[model samples]
Target chain A: MMVSLRTKSSFLKIYSWLPILALYISVLNEFDLNYLNLEYFSFNFPFILIFFFTLKDFKHFDYFLVFIAGLFNDTVVGLPLGISSLSYLLICIAAAYIRNITIRPNPVKDWFYFLFIISLINSLNYTVLTLFFSFDLILMSYLVNVFFTFTFYIIFVSIFKYYMRGLND
Target chain B: MASSRDDFIIAIRSAFLKKSTKQKFSLLTLLSISIFVIVLSSLDLKVIKYLKVGINEIVYRSSFIVSIPENLIKNAFIQTTEYTTFFNRYKRNIIELENLKSNYVSNEIIQFENKELKELINNYALSSDKILAKIIVDHDSPFLKSIIINKGSKDKIKIGTNIYDQSYLVGRVIEVNYKTSRVLLLSDLNSNVPVTIAPQNIQAIVTGSGSDYGQIKYIQSGLSDALVDDSIVYTSGTGAIFKSGVPIGKLQSFIGGSINEYKVEFYSDFTQLKYVFAEVITKTEIIKPEEKVAENNDETNNPLNVKLKILEDELKIIEETNRKFQEENEILKNEINDLNFKVSNLNNQISSQKKTINQFDIDNQELDFLKLNLKHGHKCRRTFLNTDGFIVGTLEYKSCVLSKGANDG
Candidate 1:
């Protein structure tokens, strides 16, 4: 039952990917469940992956995963795509530092923090990206999507917990 | 040998951790490649255009493979929408029949008239090349109030085609893709039409300003005979975009006073355009001036000057007709007013005479009653006096036997 690399659960590995793949397909098909629309503020699905990677270990390799995931999300659904990679990497580093003091991987604590951190990072990214272009900021839609995604994370985490019943301590 | 074992252990741990240094390097390299792709997609609209063109080229090259599947999907969507629509209509018809069954006991005549009117309107819709297009979606956002029509460029629809329904003109086509077209309604900020008044024969341009109604401008002054209902507005065909004599709408009412330009309240119910048509006929001809100067004033003076002679005759006839109609309308209005006044005065006189006759009848009744009372009193007195005389005579007879000397005196 202990968290060890040797006896890593296959279910974790399989379920770990389902969210990222779902996000990718959803972006490609413009299929949003209306539960959580992180699209407006540009805190896309890959940011969730980056958050998980950062919390697993704050190594240089984790930073690289975060950047790659960010880059992929940016390419899939973003106006200026590379900006997301940079912003996401910066947020992941900051998140790792914050994780040292807090209950790092606790779903309730980590998900809410990730919501705020990702939103802030996206807002900064949007501001920097649209600095020259006269783009109108839709604050209400952005906030709605943020809240929806956070709620979805709560629900999805519960579902994940049920599915990982055998892995529970 | 120990260092090599340690290296192998490190590789295994990194692989398990999903963070081998080699994997990390590959991740960074992939991120750079993705960044490049993002930059390429964003900075250039040409990229999208090229991508579209590339897809189109592939589609064209492999049209035998592509078009069948594409058409099948399109047909499926169309057929499904049609089937659903038919089912809805069938349900509605059943409900209507049920209502008719219940209401037939009382309002059969009214229902029959309604049926007749619906038949007429359906006939009108069928008379032309009108397409019954369903409005799939209206851009609910205020910033974009365009409507998506069921028929699009794929249906041979083109831009600038005017849209209408049984009620009235709705809008014109602005943008057209293969399977989708955007219709900008009459209430959009950028819509205009040239309308002519049938009664006054005055022409004006109507402009839309995203309001409920459009504005009519540039009408001539002093057209006083133009009533709220008199204006029969139709397409002038001056713009050459819309055909002539298509019944756009009747003039509901006029807005501004005569000094400034006036806006007409069009009778066209634009909000409901479930079916409409774009007139395909071109009704306007371009006028050339070179043909005019050749038959100028010098030619007009000649006996066979067709232009002046026709103009003079038209002027004379128009003046006479105008004057005659003006006088007739004035006379009719005056007569109407006089009849109303006379009717009121006659009513007043009849009421007064009736009041006087009632007073006289009351006075005559009082006089007759006085005469009857006097007559009755006189008759009673007379009768009493006669009786008293009779009694006195009888007593005198008795007394006379006793005193004949007193009776002789």
Candidate 2:
């Protein structure tokens, strides 16, 4: 099957804004398979999505909208306001920095870098929630979240890349 | 080294301040705003609170709408699993329902009596009304466990308002908005409840393990040994955070390496919760009896005066009863005297009749003697007949007449 896009049409317009839309939906829906009753079964879909799209510096992915999505996430997750926004913005900054320094990105290298970024973000989240906000958080959960997010990043990257290629065409 | 430092500075500055063509704000600006919001929200300002509530109301609704497909898939998956054990679950549910039905009436009675006692002890009556609330969002996130409910300030759901699943304590409200509230489930790590272990009567705190169960913590050191498996765990009402005697869970003992570890398996399944009840409590102070009297009347008669009045009324009743008894006694005495007089008159009449009977007996003897004398008149005449006879009117004449009559017979 051949795929093509009609320029300036509503479908194309919606297609261009898919990443930001995904970000909003991810924050709002929080698609964690928690009902599976699996112990330690969670991954940060927004983290992986944000890292991949922001690293590509996608034109339609708005930073302000990301910040707003973070706010929505905090509300839905019952976290202190702006906590997720800080974490999301921090991911954007890290992705931006990595983009600036690398002329050509290797998937393996970006994957490892994502592992590091998510670890740092999760640790930062744990610290801020526990110390600053007086939240009782399990360190193990954060570790598990980091591990799952890191493991899923590469799988999601392929899908995001396919979308990127479709947009380019 | 100086060139490398300059390159690093450029990259950092570009990352912080550079905005792409489609981006409205740089990363640094959003980050600063996030930090500002965090600080402001932490401080709990009125404006910030209202703003947060407004955001929560909208976001919770949006989340509910957005989570529809996911919730559908989740329910389908759960229902598929539930069908495998359908009969067993049904049988178990039937048995449980029977037991619960039996306990329900007694439990209600105990709860009502408990409320009365609590009111008496607290000097205020707490009339709690539980409002039904729909669970708008139940993420069951591992890090922070909470759910958004459809009851809030409009439904009188305040912070710390207890949430329940059919009388089972599930959680408490931590955040409230206009029509939405956030309940921190007992399975959350931050959720700590003061609880009592039954049969042992030991007190401890139950903190959520961020899983399906709660860990018993802050118990007295040696009291842990007394805890047995399947012991009841209920709220102790310490810290005034939860109502006393609200059942939380059952205590389960597990081996944690060398020592026994105790955990509370919550009575409510947080994952399956669709609707919950939020208790809205209103406490009205109890007016003392004296105060009630003073409010109702200004006669100034207190409890002592009331008691005295009751005693005086009792005395009057006793006196009236005694007077009636005396009047009855006087009437009885008059009747007895009249009866005695009638009895004496009857006795005199009896004696007169007895004397008249004796006179009649004498007249009958004289008549009998005159008849016998006429039959033997010549023999009965003492002077003409024989010298042995005496005067005719003497007793001897009568005897002689009777003897002559006997001799002639």
Candidate 3:
């Protein structure tokens, strides 16, 4: 009986690390459904995962791991090595600032704030990639990506909340 | 107000500098590192390049392994769609195959002649071998169009090596690692192919529209008017970036608010590329026989041997020229014999035709006479009551009959 309880606890520990694991998988696999053939139909999954975990201050969501995931994202997407890392770190900082300011965080406010944060981060990303890296990115693509990432955040956050609830239980 | 201001500053500072127990670094530190890395990467350094290469090799392989399941799903979906349209595609392919087959012979002859002419002009020949590479990661990034292939410096794939999807230009390698390379697809916004628009022979640069098509740019103002829809766009080999005459896409005209736009629909779908060829070219200088001889012989050689060598070379040239002349003479002789045979055959035909014409003339005359004889022959015949006519078989009697029996009248 003791052995089974120990195994269950270990399993719970692994389960708690799922968000970061998903972030790594999403970056390496580039978890955008591009095969759907919808024009300008991509959303950054890592951004959503990073934003939620960092806001909640999940114990397993290491900043270094997120930074490394960003590097992997850049390599896979053929960007400069640290571009995604910078964007991801910025998202973390923004989430952290918001987390610190709010006493009783409202979900609706958080959702709208998430939109604003992604917009600013995406704009910064576009500026850095275009000005510094000399990349020729379409403004419309970045806009659409920001829109979709913001729109999908609430949906993903709800699911993440359920997982959080289960973890606490 | 002062306390509130302090709260805001405190929050901001905490967010930047605070590190939780489980986190190894603060967000500010990581952010600074990211910026430092970006600045370092932008500067050209050999150590940084090697480091980037090492990182790329590991990440590319890991990405490929991690992407396998997703790739399988994507492939399955694509296969399903292909099967749905298989019959129609097969029919279209059949028609295109037949047309291509008829053009294949002429194309081969043109390729051979082009090779010979290029060799004669360039003083060196480029022998290229294409190595097949499988795509390892094709994430189809929304911002950038690029793919990672499982070939790199180890396979002689260098930056700017032209990648092809069956002779159609796909893109060029932008980055190379030890065992992998990234190809910036021609559909990327940064990709600009110097191309010549066919049929009009207009030279222009095609920049990617950050989509599946490319846009024509940098053309002379009036040349845009000459670009019709479906005009072929091919690499002009201008600027020595790409090989000449490689087909890129076809032009598609779009009119938007009193302005005309031309887009190039690429021949090879960058999205569908599973494998591509990287052309590794090696140039060899042509060495003349004289140069070879000069290298082998010593300076101590007598003037006589040099004179003899020149004479031998001259003799060889003369003999070659003579041989070519003899072949030409043989061809001309054969042509002359053929013409003579034709002329003799025509003469025989003319004589036979003349004989036939004469026969026809004689028959017509005989018919005329017979018609006249119905009345005049009786009048001119040596009959019992026509003693004034001579015998019918006599020449004088024939003449009299020909006179329409005038003498008898």
Evaluate chain B of model 2: give its TM-score.
0.70
Please provide, for model 3 over B248-317, each residue's C-alpha lDDT reduced to its tens digit, 9 standing for 90 to 100: 9999888867988888999998888899999988889976444566688766255676667657756765
Query: Which sections of candidate 3 miss by over 4 Å?
Result: B289-409
TM-score of each: 0.38, 0.78, 0.80
The fraction of reference A/B contacts recovered in model 2 reads 0.89
Measured by DockQ, the strongest candidate is 3
**Which residue segments of model 1 deviate by more than 4 Å?**
A1-104, A128-133, A159-169, B1-47, B50-176, B181-285, B288-409
lDDT of 1 by residue, B1-409 (tens): 9996776665444333333452454333544555565566555576653553343233222322322443345446556766878977999999999998867643544444444444333322212356667654332222123455656666777787777765366667875555545577665445667777787777776665443456666666556346356467777868766655555555555445654334455555443333466533232332222234345645535445545644654565567556666776798899999999999999999999999999999899667545543543333222545553223234443333334333334
Of the true interface contacts, each candidate retains a share of: 0.07, 0.89, 0.81
Write out the backbone clash pairs for model 2. Answer: none
lDDT of each: 0.52, 0.88, 0.88
- The local distance difference test score of model 2 is 0.88
TM-score ranking of the models: 3, 2, 1
DockQ score, prediction 2: 0.60
